[model samples]
Target: MMRTRPLKVALLGCGVVGSEVARIMTTHADDLAARIGAPVELAGVAVRRPDKVREGIDPSLVTTDATALVKRGDLDIVVEVIGGIEPARTLITTAFEHGASVVSANKALLAQDGAALHAAAEEHGKDLYYEAAVAGAIPLIRPLRESLAGDKVNRVLGIVNGTTNFILDKMDSTGAGYQEALDEATALGYAEADPTADVEGFDAAAKAAILAGIAFHTRVRLDDVHREGMTEVTAADFASAKEMGCTIKLLAICERAGDGASVTARVYPAMIPLSHPLASVRGAYNAVFVESDASGQLMFYGPGAGGAPTASAVLGDLVAVARNRINGTTGPGESAYAALPVSPMGEVVTRYHISLDVADKPGVLAQVATVFAEHGVSIDTVRQQGKDGEASLVVVTHRASDAALGGTVEALRKLDTVRGVASIMRVEGE
Candidate 1:
């Protein structure tokens, strides 16, 4: 039996994602009502520009006062697409206090202060679902939170940011330098005007923090994840990657230690073998690879971002929260029972590829080899090419602590024969 009375929903922010949420709500009202067992109404839409025409939204429902809209006391659900910290945080807590569930797409807010927001929702006995927060419409959050609840996830590796992936993909295919690739990405609208958030790995790091928390059932913050931007990736780096049957990608990696006592999260540009599934991911697409105890390897791949794609995720959460409202129940809340300490970058063990400019002399190689030996870092392979009075030595090292690798590099830099450190890249996906 379906309820005839409508469930009121308040929408905050009517920009790209918010507008689409409204459009879908109206256009699919009949279907949503049937699925949710009650009619859903867009009671009000909060926006900065109330006078601007929103195509499918009613003018009467528009308001500049978002705070008042969420506090209307009749709303069953509040869809927050306003991506930030301040008012979004306050408004969400307020919405729960006023008897409404929240479906948000604010990754930054969640990454920074998810525990507090989750506490607020739990305090008010309301559902807090944010499926659109990570990897756009790929359905990562809910799966990690619900579908894989019974399973033990050990590692999560992904290309989370489309902008950086687009730029790196261009550099790999066209052999263009970082600047040239970034300019192309900007022109194609794949990158923002400032592009710092995407290019500098901040965007991916935020997503990594969120994914790490849920996957490991731990509390991982944005600052906990180590971040390295892709701005310094050069065409020569890609050339070396080709020589080793690999390609470069900006990856977000989250892992639980072997004993399952600690976890680590990081974002950096790495060289993955062409045979790896992630290496084939091109353009602005996103893919996440998960390894668990029961489920050996699972991959989720799709369009990571776009108004429509992200809006699709938001709407899916809307339907879920709406159904839960009708049933008088809540979905899964935060699960930080593990509470694993996030390990620092120095403790992370991984392979490295280092390139060095040295004097084309006989004993220069011995000196470079000695540095690695002193640091207890084993060498996998070494390739040295002579050009006039100078030579380039490319060294691929075996698995070693990041601290050891850093020490080895520092020692090499002080050697008189070492002219310059051309590049140092982490190698992964073996």
Candidate 2:
């Protein structure tokens, strides 16, 4: 019953991920054909540098004009591995218009304009699957979109960025400072030269936006996600965390508010209990915890990046979309039925680990405790260390709104006894 006519697939961006995708398609042609009920052919490969030699790809099949390749109405699928906004966005839209479904690995573009892209696919009656967008090889999107379609997911918390994890893990294991750990990450090729996107939480923030939108069934844009980078994470922070039976990690957290009427998405460096699954997720690996009403808790962990891993996800989507094509159907589109409002960061309720530099004297602690009390932030515990008339007062506050914590810090900074607000981090996964 297999179709003799092969399905033509156009590959855009012959880079790290695109090349691997092509290699896989060619090597696994027979299997894909049998599984998909149709032989899959790599019709064209679009690349900026056509002269660059790509092994296993035909020289005649390469083209510099990506737009034109996708415009060919004969294409059944357009796999976009170009990790950017402009060209990828336009090409993806164009592909749908010309009768081709899309499989993309562009996180930034999807996180930015996923609704628009989904609409484009739906308008043309095509599938737009981006399983490779969020967490490289890990199958996160489809689960949130399809598998958990019946269940209500309340909380999603985990270490989503591998680069930051590597840096933080190195610091925790080797007692290295932020700079030292970042340098090691860069040397090991775990971090980029600039590393702004990964370290600054922008990368994780985009993924958070995607997760929140899907998990909450609302439109969560990139701007909606509150992002705080890991650059400010210091060795002393790790020591403080260790003392509290915790470790620091850059986490992407999405949650439904108390009433389940609103949602919150944020990416930042926080202290998670050492016993938590995410804390043990060392090296450049990704792990996510999905808490639901029925499923209780589910953890998805794997290598979140690299060519081969990402390509695997891309191929999974490709096979799915191919099956849909053969069946003359499409997968689930955007599910913003709830349309819950995304609450601001100030409204987010979580514990705070605040370190303050204060004068070593009586009544200083009382004044600080009064500030917390006045702001409605109850102190769970307080530890003070004095040295040469200067003191480090570490306070862990019970669950409180971010606005109250901000107000407390502002009030503490104004007190003459308080030298500085040394550091403030959120305590999560407790």
Candidate 3:
């Protein structure tokens, strides 16, 4: 039996994603209602600019006051497309307090204050679903949170940010410098004007924090993630990557460390082998490689951003939350029961590809080797090329703690024979 009473949904924000959500809800209203076992209605839409005309939304639904809209006691679901902390957080909590479930695409807010938000939802006995937060429409959070609930996920490594991936992929394919690739991405509208959040790894770091928390069932905050921007990635880095039969990508990596006692999450530009699934992920696309004991290795790939793609994910969560509401229940809340401690970056063990500018002399290599040996970072390979009394010495190291690699670089910088540390990139997927 289907419910005759319509489920009232309030949309906060009428921007790109919000508009698409409304469009879909209107066009696919019958289908959504049939699937959800209840008629879904767009009861209200709140935006900052009420004067701006939205295609399908009613003028009566548009309002400047977001708080007032969410506070409306009749709303059954509040969908937040507003991507920020202040108003979004407060609005979500208010929605729960007033008896409404929430579906959000705010990664930054969730990554920072997910625990509090989850608590608020639990207190109000409402569902808080954010499937679109991490990788646009890639369907990641649900799998890690629900699908893989029975399995133990050991590792999650992938290119999660499409902007950074576009820049890095451009650099690899065209041998363009970072500026050139970033400029192209901007012109193509794949990058924002500021682009700091995406290029600087802040965006990916937030996603990493979310993934690490859910995958490991721990409370991983945004501050817990180790972030390194890809702005410094040069054509020379791509050249070195090609020489090693690899390609460069800005990766978000999360892992369980040392018998699952701790977990780690980081975002950085790293060299993944050419054959790896992530290296082949070209242009503004996303792919994640998940490793587990029973599942072995699984890859989730898709267009990570854009209004329609992101809206698809938001609608998926909408149907889910709607169905749960019809059933008089809630979905999975925060699974931080594991409470695994997030280890510092220094404790992360990984291989590294380090390029150094040094004097073209015999003992320079020996001095560098001594530093690595002293720091307990074993070198896997060393390649030296000389030109005009200057040499570019590239050293690939075996799996070693980040602490040892940092000490090695610090000591190498102090050496007179070493001109400078040109670049240091982590080697992954091998």
Candidate 4:
């Protein structure tokens, strides 16, 4: 007879991800038991409203008082899907203090206060696993935290937000403007009513913070990430992308500085060459590309977010934490050992594509090229076309610091020959 520990789990929130947690718990019971060498059971469910009907769940398991549920006796694990910084953080801390391991899908809470939560878990010697907090259902946090435990990771570049990727992919394939693609995504339920977090790059920035901290074993907080949303990305940007043999994607990029003394993490819309693997990751899917000393380039791709997919990731973490419990061992904790400083955006090195609307004069092109030269940013290519009293100058520059590029743009904007600086975009995945 196999020795069974009879794990009791309390799940909070029955939203998209929580319902899937219940469904999988019911169907995978025997398999879960076999894998854990024990019977895992749902002890309780914490929800805001108790009157709402929920299926595949024992009515006795549901409760309106979430705080009271965590305080109840004998909970082996608490899975939090409520998602916020306040009660969720307080509830998770309480659960850990009460001798329960925690599995969470709360990215904001984790990104904002992961350090505090991890400290609480450490003080109580409990597990705090949040595999679903990043890319939904993609095996990223685990692989970065564990599988690459020995490898030296230099970079983690990803399309970590699904809604933005879906919108961008739609725009890429259909040549639709930002609003047009956003409308289609909204109609399809891929985007929320507000869509601020997804489109504005806030969501991806949080994920980047979490990923940078883990990959570099440093405390890279959410505020440390430089965020520039994709709302400003126009249809013309996509058209220019096509002209340059590229696609525009909202990328969450984190990389170790060349000196290896610091790291840089940012979320912004970027133009990437079509040959890159990440360019092929279309629709609402997510992909993460990692560069390491030992592992040169590695990519993990799958459905980024959905209730069921994210729940699947939580369950996978459940199995790992459960087995670790049976063995009386704790997994890795926050490893900011690299303790690298988070660098500013001005220090980042990348290529740029600058579109200039200038007065149609004989020397306008040379004046624009002169501005770039003064800043030490060499131009790779320049294409100019004259229109009615105005000319459009498209200049692609070789790699240079963001500071240098910004200086060049500032000087160009001041030029008498330049009517206006239309746009400046970063070129990535080259």
Candidate 2, residue 75: lDDT: 97
Model 1, which residues run further than 4 Å from truth? none
TM for every model, in the order presented, reads 0.99, 0.99, 0.99, 0.98
Could you give candidate 3's per-residue lDDT for residues 1-430 as a string of tens digits?
7899999999998899999999999999999999999999999998988899899889998888888888889999999998989889999999999999999999999999999999999999999999899899998999999899999999999889999999988898888889999999999999999999999999999999999999999999999999999999999999999999999999999999977899999999999999998889999999999999889999999999999999999999999999999899999999999998999999999999999999998899999999999999999999999999999999999999999899899999999999999999999998
Number of backbone collisions per candidate, in order?
0, 0, 0, 3
The collision pairs in model 2 are none
Candidate closest to the true structure, highest lDDT: 2
Taking the tens digit of each residue's C-alpha lDDT, what string does model 2 give over 149-187? 999999999788899999999999999999999999999
**lDDT tens digits, residues 315-365, model 4?**
999998888888888888778767889999999999999998989878888
lDDT against true structure, model 4:
0.92
In model 4, pairs of residues that clash are 217-335, 217-336, 218-336
User: Can you write out model 1's per-residue Cα lDDT over 1-430, one digit (the tens) per residue?
Assistant: 9999999999999998898888888889999898888999999999998879899888999999999999999999999999989899999999999999999999899999999999999999999999899999998999889889999999999999999999999999988899998899999889999999999999999999999999998989999999999889999999999999999999999998767789999999999999999999999999999999998899999999988899899989988998898888899999999888999999999999999999999999999999999999999999999989999999999999999999999999999999999999999888
User: Which portions of model 3 miss their true places by more than 4 Å?
Assistant: none
